[model samples]
Target: MDSKRYIQLLKKFDGLDADTEGENTRSSVSYAILSNSETNQLQKCLGARLFEQGFQPKLIKTEFNNFATDSLDTEGELFQSDLDFVFFVLSPMGLKETIPSELNERSQFASSFLSELEMFVKNFSNKGVKVFLANIPETSERVFGNMSRIYPASFLYQIQAINAGINNLVAKSQGLYLVDLASKANYYGLSEWHDNGLWLQGKYPCHPRFFPTICDEVSAIFSSLVGKIQKCLVLDLDNTLWGGVAGDDGIDGVKIGDGIVGEAHVQFQKYVLDLKNRGVVLTIASKNYEDVAIDIIENHPRMILRKNDFAVIKANWEDKASNIQEIAAELNIGLDSLVFLDDNPFERGIVRDHLPQVCVPELPEDPTEFVDFLTQLNLFETTQFSDEDLSRSEFYYSESERKSLQKNAVDLKNYLSMLNMEACVKPIDEKSLPRSVQLSQRSNQFNLRTQRIDEMTCEKYIKEPDKFCFTVDLTDKYGALGIISCVFMSLKKDHLYIDEFIMSCRVLKRTVESLIFNEILNIAKENKAKFVVGEYIRTKKNKLVENLYQDYGFENTERSDEGSLWRIEVSGFSDLDTSIKVKRS
Candidate 1:
């Protein structure tokens, strides 16, 4: 493939490219390579590709060292610099002799190396750097083995074991990615690269042709890691969800009974279940009755998903785009997280135009292709799966229930009182710091300002006398809602500047805002400040918070080309009576 074709393929693969634009702008990402060679042809190819696309490519030379010397410290020095990715080249290294035994019996050197690598990744991830592990060329295997025929039997096994170790390390490291170079090359086979075989090809060990291909693969993997994956998969009911439409042919007539189509849906549901297992939230935005959809999913012999499978279901009579946004609000997730799936082109087009970030998968004519299509479109891939993934669907499902409770109430004030809620506020310590920063970066609606703060920045803010950051954990008689909200404020002059005020949409209309206002006013009063000020910065998905200041009686005192600002007098601002008991940490 040409450079353009390579880029297109990378986009198709949803790989990383820092200068991603046009149709593949969503896939833009940055990457760096870790290598033992500084001037290899593969590195040149990588640099060229990145340069053409206006992306800065990083390359690290992996020089061998005698552990008896200060190689570890030197490696540490190299790692302290800015790096997002590393490809440990195993070729030049004499792996056959080196792999089976540790440099020391305790394996201290290797452990230290891996541990340092892990620390680097964690620190970088906290700074928003994504790292990937790349497999060294397989051609190096024979070369290394030829040089160590005495250990011929253990040669391949040794390299495999080292690769496995790297894989394990990558899996354990947060924000670390892996590129299966060996597997990909093996799939296409040696014949594809060489006239005789991969070994005979002119490109064999540092092969010029293989370098470009491998570089492309590495670049593609990096692209995929840089951006946020789509969160929710909004599925249709008919052939998309199940096998047939229940409205046309009745519940029994639906193809999701005990047939081939039925099996396809069964597998499809299992796939969706796997996504949920990994925290990719599922929601149904179908044009069918809620009861009917639930019945099919619950009672059907072929069904694998149940009523609780969906985080938010919009089975009511509504436009797909409208329903999708509603789902986003209910789950407290962004519209960008939504990936709308429909069998009909019209519905897909509607969502595509109305909700552009809501990824609308191309409608395939056949149902069997559904799995393959989605597999290729790995919109749900994450760098790591957290404990939260297992219960995310239930969390959003409970969020929907909370919304239902709010809807029946007379007003926001009454709704908050009726819930008999309590807030558990806490300073973000070591245990809660990651989750707090993650929420700060990810939370969309109800967010006053969308500042993507890092963990270090959060720590610094928490220590500042002028600033305050607190997370609110809310729970009522309904269920335990974990870390439902957060607020960041600072004292400035005669006012308490509300820098960040965001609550989980699950806690919406529950007087969380009023409670926050009261807390801020109390802080202002205690600090001897005369006024409380706040800003409403606009993001496409956070329009819900634009009028938030008005709800809390904060009048617009300043308006500029940048954004709107509001302030409430500490003396005059009345603390809205809230039933939710507040506890400060």
Candidate 2:
């Protein structure tokens, strides 16, 4: 490792410390690096770097002193005194020999740490603490080209497995994140281990010159773990001071063609467009003639985004809330998922007042700094990007067509019947867990009890005989409305308590809810449950469901300040006429 690179790395961590000091800091994360001899020195170096980065890191010294209490719970008590995240740094010796022998073949004492770790996660997660796990640097064959003492291949493989298993276990147990830092460390080699050096000194990976950059990247990943980044960017057009009326400017004159102002808007639009490509849903909300705006989007030479770029567009003379509602409806997305943007403060204010779920970005005085302003907002940062986000705009366009067709039909049954709607209700599976969790998190209007559970928790329910989760998938002539609803219930003697019930807004008037209710009833009948009980948890966005149970013939049996409980006798409940065809999984 180069000495200058080590100094640079130290400086980068110092910079992070300066940036985070006195910013309503939380309980510091106590990181424990579990490693042996050769890796011990490296862990110490990383620990030193973590201290400079505004984090406290500790290396646990494991010895065969007091086999039970001191090595397990008592020792954990000493180490986990105030720990937030535990980073396990493994080496060839640490994996094949150190851990298995030291921990004694997954003995009862080893099991103790797993339990202790679980408790830590549940306690900390409830309080909003984050955890991260980083593996040691990958030893590159190319970089270690002539080194005689190479790490044994079997040892490397075993260590990787142990690291992966521990990472997954901790993630499941602690709800913390596992970041792959090994490849990154190797890429940067041992250059400026910390930054505070010349820019060109540690920019690339080919030479041993980017260690500071690697440290910077690791610090950034940790920072991201501590915060939830905005997922979408909403855009607007017309003179809050763009040059001309989109309708009147005739595409060429409208400020976004090829000049300074146009260049600025183009740059801003391109910045947002890139965010969308990286899985942020970009939407437009402009009060303009739709045809004129569409023309400009199609014909403008400098415009990077066309009609295809926007996930949804709200271009109408209607109030911003109403327009935003349409946008949400078309996108099959929740209002909370949107970030509204417009030049007019009045429009922004109206949206802020009516639709509090949507994020409204402040307008910058200089149009030139619009892109810079967004960067400052950091409104579109995310760690994971799924494939669905890339084609979200096209999906919304298709959904609009579905909605238009849905409106033409007379009633719920009629609409469902005409479209040939099919509902597939099934026990929750791995493939549908993410969507189920999303329903719990996002479905406020039709949600009952608003219980949010991650995939692991959901998996437990599906396999539990006493509890059941049924998700609904609907497909019409238009397209598939992937896993639109979920119902989690616990079966007791003669009664079933509805723990969770939520449906997507896109399937609102399509008799999907009625079909789901009917399916649950069928299940209850088969199980010999006499009645179904439902709990309603009030939230800001779930007012639409205040009378949901009443509308569905469920009578209030219990009421309290926290939530309302309703009950319905299975025998007495009528099977309502629904046009939706049902299937079981």
Candidate 3:
């Protein structure tokens, strides 16, 4: 969508009535914009972009200089609003007003400024709200000119110090993110990003023409926070990965790895290899003979990604959409996680029309620009990375091997026993907290009552007396699957309520569910509870686990349009016999 159309839609939404606005909002996300300058134009641009990305954005803009105190209501009590994200949009001039211009007095002012910012971030993060701190941009007007470069306490030096300090804080903090506004301004050129005439009259830091670029960055950050990050990249074989069709032109005739045109595809493949190394799954969904494609992939010396690199290869004469669905099912991920890349415009259009969830970027007319175009899209922006992420492709390969073993076993019990599985259940601590939060954010298919949370909330559950939060790490004879399941339960006087239950889809049929259910019963029994309650919250991707409570002997208590409530008496709980070993810590 164009910038003018986006502005028009924002005006239409701004004029909507309360009831009509509430009715149109889907997948509701509450956010706040705290800025010292006029932010109505930026907020409108952000809302339009977020809405285009399928989020129903509900935003509140605080008055200038009210960042700390605006969270409270008019009665001087804490407000009941549940905010998902908060953006602190700070301009260098706004912060300069509070700090002294004298070189000798600047150190004390910097200390106090950082302290106040840290306190504000901590206050909101304790409530599970993600905070985005925009780095202060440099002043367009150089007051000291060349002297500012040498002086330690100059305005430019102070701003750079603050940005460095913010980066350090974000590195240590769990839920705080840094927006590099200075680098973005430098890229777009200061002359185009800032207008001195408009800034002097209206106090607008950024020019109106660059609102679209600013909002695109904001939209990318918002998408990453809400688990909209893409996981897999599905590629086509002929003309997409090489210079020509392999089947028609023959393997030796296909241009690759020598000339300028072939070097473009080579560079593209090298870029894709980098993505795979960072943990994005590489896949192939081509419409060629399976054996013919595999033979070329195995023998081609210039190929950056070989046969072993792909998690799933659907190289048959099938429709592209169906091939993508098969890949999703095989990988046990949502369709939204896949990004389809094809050189043919017709193929791209077919996938876009049939499966709207998949992200399909428009390839430029020149193949030489493909790498630059994909890099600019930033479709796989992630805030956190772990050791498990680096080894994710290996984990999927292990899962495929496990499935083959399951098919050959005599029965369910024999299959599980032969695998030799061991589960370690432990309370959430410093070492296990990162993976636990990741599982909460990523798991979808086997999740019952999906409750997304941040690291602070997971830590709170671990420290609270009446709450029980634990993670399960499983290892078999094949390999170690790190932190596959998580459970959060709240203990009441008469009953234990299960707040969240989620497990990785790779370990679904190995009786891990039964083991976790038994552990929950044990906790309830130890607390002398009368009943244990569970819920099945329906979602677009969680239908696989809708009947989970029923399968676990939890009697249905009430049914609603939203979800079903279930309860099982402690006395009625019985243990199931399993061959896997369990250790509690």
Q: What are the Cα lDDT values of the candidates?
A: 0.64, 0.61, 0.80
Instruction: Give the higher-lDDT candidate: 2 or 3.
Output: 3
| Model 3 lDDT tens row, 1-585 | 235754665675575334243344358767777776767777776776776677777776556557667543333222345777877777666677777867798756656777778887777766677888888777766677887755667777777777888989898998888777887788777777666677677767677666666667777877766667788899998988888888897778776799987899999999988888888988999989988888778888887778878888889888999999988888888899899999999999999999988999998867799898897678787767876777777777677777778779979998899989999998888888877777888777778887876787888898998999888899998888888999999998899999999899888778888889889999999989899999888877788988889987899998886789999999987986666699998
**Order of all candidates by lDDT, from best down to worst?**
3, 1, 2
Pairs that clash in candidate 3: none
TM-score of 2: 0.63
Writing each residue's lDDT as its tens digit, candidate 1 over 24-104 gives 222222334443333244545665555443344544433332221212343463446555555544342333334435323
TM-score for each candidate, following the candidate numbering: 0.71, 0.63, 0.90
Which consecutive 10 residues in model 3 have the weakest lDDT in total? 71-80
Q: Which candidate should be chosen as best, given TM-score against the real structure?
A: 3
Q: Candidate 2: global Cα-lDDT?
A: 0.61
Question: How far in Å is the alpha carbon of 155 misplaced in model 1?
Answer: 5.2
Q: Mark the regions of model 2 whose C-alpha exceeds 4 Å error after superposition.
A: 1-174, 178-232, 238-249, 254-280, 316-335, 342-357, 362-392, 410-412
Q: What is the descending TM-score order?
A: 3, 1, 2
**What shift in Å separates residue 550 of candidate 3 from its native position after superposition?**
1.2
